[model samples]
Target chain A: MTDPRLLPRTIAVLGCGGLGVPAAWTLALDGRYPLVLIDDDCVELSNLHRQVLYATAEVGQPKAPALARALLEVAPQLQVEVRQGRLGPANAAALLQGCDAVLEGTDDAVSKFAVNDWAVGAPAGVQRVASIAAAIGRRGQWMVVRSAGPCYRCLFEEPPQPESLATCQIAGVLGPAVGQVGALAARSLLRVLAGEADSADGALVRLQARGLLRTPVAAAAACRCQARGDGAADSEPWGQHV
Target chain B: MFERDPKQLFDRYGRQLLVQGVQFEGQQVLHRLAVVVGCDGSPLAQAAGQVAARYLVGAGVGRAVVPQGGGTLLQQLDPLLQLAELPSEAQPPVVQLWFAARAYGASADVVWTDLSPQGPRQVRAGALQWWVGGPAPLTDAVALGAAVADLVVADALGVEPLPSLAVLDFSDPLAPRTRKHAAAAGPPLALPADPGSPLQELASKLSETLQIQQIVAAESARCYPAEACGLVVADADGQLVALAVANLQDHWHSQDPEAFSRSARTAFALDERAIAAQQRLGRRLVAIWHSHCDVGADFSAADVSGAYPNGEALYPGVAHWVVSVRRGCVAEQRVFGLEGGQLCYADVAVSGELAGRSGVEGRC
Candidate 1:
């Protein structure tokens, strides 16, 4: 088995928002890993605190390219592949192809659940691939999900109502809090790449003022998402939605 | 979207601030930063030297260092504040300093990052949008200085517990220990769980300095099979400056066979001459520290009699500290004190800026 720790690995950062920018910036500064950035959104004035990738001057620019350029400004030696579009059920499998691991920093619950589905249902070669998700603000959760443990569907079968999940947009966020999670997510990725094993397969690690809280999660016997066919093994050609 | 001046932010929310939320020692870090705030009309926005020195005492931070020399120009105040305490307020301050700086750049000119994830929204520090927004940005010089202090504190407080330390119980963990030495040590001084207490702050400063512990442990290991002793002095305010004195155990062993017997290997007897030297240095004896080379830091029967001859508390307020030096390294330390007729483990804490999230209580 190849030791990812000794070798450089590619990571797909699924969003270029608050969580993604700092995570990617810190990771790139580590000076080892190449990054694949996927985001269709544009930089705006409001995300300055959390989404630090885009500066004030680049407000109107698309985040995918803006973030790529900004990351280069911080780390010129790092390799970055920009895919300026959203990841959906239709394109997530393709967008996520050929990466050692995936970092899901998007705020959308549906997208998070879908990525969880794909991670759990991906066919051989990609079946064991893992994705680490982090959300920040007054209230947020971070989790490491792979088939070895439990899927996101095991924890929550469906996304909550829009009113239930408040991003920094509705409920404000703290500067240091975002920083804590970003640095934490980046550390988790480095650890995973180091081939450090996690005993509790599916655990949602909650950030606290003092440290972290890890809650073990087991695959639900009744979860229907876990029973779906492996999408990566599908014989269907490109453009066919899973 | 309307733009507001950054100066207006401070006028509405003055600088005299207090840092809260991280609990306990975080406030001490803030207090140290307050002591080092830049003077009026100074070129630097703030000088963190004193702050870093008092709070960041080790980990390679230096004194008389070259300033960042970046774009900060200091603010002028009427009567400079050596220590400013803003009385408790409803909303805990990020850092409270009486707003005192003439910012070289205007608020509208300096770009502020929106901490929100919705996108980079406009962020105005002061009261312009504070009515509905998150805590105002720490925009003032004093506040930023405090933030810098906090940044260092957070870094220093991240020391994880080493598995090698099976610490000797100096103070009973089950029964909270408090030592009465100063005016502030009234009642049982429970180690504070939160900041802002006068007693806890003093107790924090009284915890032995890390450098002295390292020095004493290193000095002791060099003279193996022989105990090492030192007389450490603290300023009137309780900051320790340790001075190693020769342990006259071998001299006594050469003459008095009983005195030199097992005592030379396990015990320490401080040479009295160092006291005059220490007093001339204008430092009061705070702790009489010695090292136990081969065993745990527990005080032995001979150790007790040697310190408090005839069951009398010879050193009324001084702490007797034991540094267990095993295999040429400091393994752990335990402190004992004589107060109110009982020799109890003195509760001493070296409180730093950030509270480790693990809730693993600290000695300093």
Candidate 2:
């Protein structure tokens, strides 16, 4: 098998909100992997505080294209593809086609799990890695899922009810707090690409009030990821990609 | 001797002002906070130096002193942050971020990251030390840079109490371990009052906790050689039940040896589904019980990170009982919990026998 690391990998970023904005920007600044930005939401006046990629003048513009333009303006060498649409199980494969990794930063619970399920369910030939991150009210958590480790569902079996948990819209969030998470997510992806996947994989890194706390997570036997055949068969020989 | 228009500052940093700690006074502290990024010839160090500088500027820090070649990206990232030269005379409370190896200095607080024989390590000193290590890779420089910036900001904002020393091992990145030492006297950060012993508190409050030692002892002995894990849940009747949740460590290690390097013999992973089922029982989770084979009954670093995942308690008000299983016999047991934001453990005498469901108490 060809060494996948030798090939230039494409990354698909889901959700262009607080976490995605900085994540996309950080990846663009790195200027290594080609990026595919997907988001149906438009730039809002309220998003400017935490979503640093958008400006006041760009309000009402689709987030994916606006972010692409913003990235190109700063680092013209970047290869960025814009897919302006909502991502679900149906279109996840098409939207993330030919991508080696996915950075899921969507705010809602449904979209996050959808991305997780899709990644965990990928076939042998199309095995891909993913990093899912969420931020709200001064705190955030990010985890990277690879074939060898636990999927997002393994840690959080299911998302809590909307009423039970407060979204950033309701509880409020600081710009720097989410911004820090976004950067962490982007850096984590870079680690995976740089052949240092351990630092970013399988563990959940929480951005707490004081410092970053990382907890190791394992696949639950009952979790679908554990029964996943593709995860075992298609997992690249470790260190080959590096 | 610093004066800036409050209206303009608010216009730029309005969202920051809304945060609790960064409300007017904290924002001023951040604005007054100066960080020095020391660079070296190494490419990794240079990249990390630049990442730290950019992050500090984006955070609305007042002034930054970057070694000449490093501030090129700072001006483009943010124009508000003033890039100044290193101070000549007595420095005033500046946090220094060193990307290369350096001896600890007395004057300024330091967030240091260096490549070591073991791996990449980060040390944050505000009268505290946090040493995090994993394999040495190029990304370590960038991760360390961001980590340093976070520590600097946390110190300025007083987000977390400073521990005298915290050793974080990422060798097994999947299951990282964090061990914290109590802060020394006269530390920069204020220490909160002691919350007292969690083991003693649990023993006194719950009669079952004291009586169920035999149940835990028998189970630990049964799961000998392989580490055992379970939960202590209170049913609707408010009766504490010892439920043996599957370890799942060996299962993961067998499936993915590269990621899960440790097996059931040395480590333990409680079933997430089991924990969630207990969580849904309306605040019935009293404590998570597990056995450490040959590792002693005291709470290990893994226990600390597992119980308080994300710096917040996974199960608030939940005490963790760690039983030591030595040579197929229960030697001792201890209870651990978070007290005043620190992991504190107390030894509990194994006494009393309770008749309950035996052998594989609950689902894996």
Going through the candidates in order, their DockQ values are: 0.05, 0.08
True contacts kept of each: 0.00, 0.09
lDDT (Cα, 0-100) at B37 in candidate 1? 24
Model 1 over residues B43-153: C-alpha lDDT tens digits?
223322222222222111111112243211111110111322222211221222111122111010011122234554332111000000111112221112322332333
lDDT of every predicted structure (CA atoms) = 0.47, 0.63
Q: For model 1, what is the alpha-carbon lDDT of residue B179?
A: 17
What tens digits encode model 1's per-residue C-alpha lDDT throughout A28-59? 65657789988888875555434534445666
The sequence of per-residue lDDT tens digits that candidate 2 reaches over residues A1-242 is 33556543788889998788778867876777799999999976556556655655677889999889877975699999998878766777677778778888998786777777776676666556778999876678898776555778787888779788876655656665676677678777666655554555767898775456887777535455533546545655233552
Q: lDDT per residue, candidate 2, B47-94, as tens digits?
A: 556655555565567677766655555654454557776544214445
Candidate 2 runs further than 4 Å off: A5-8, A16-18, A21-32, A39-78, A146-149, A169-221, A224-242, B1-23, B66-78, B83-94, B101-135, B161-168, B178-364
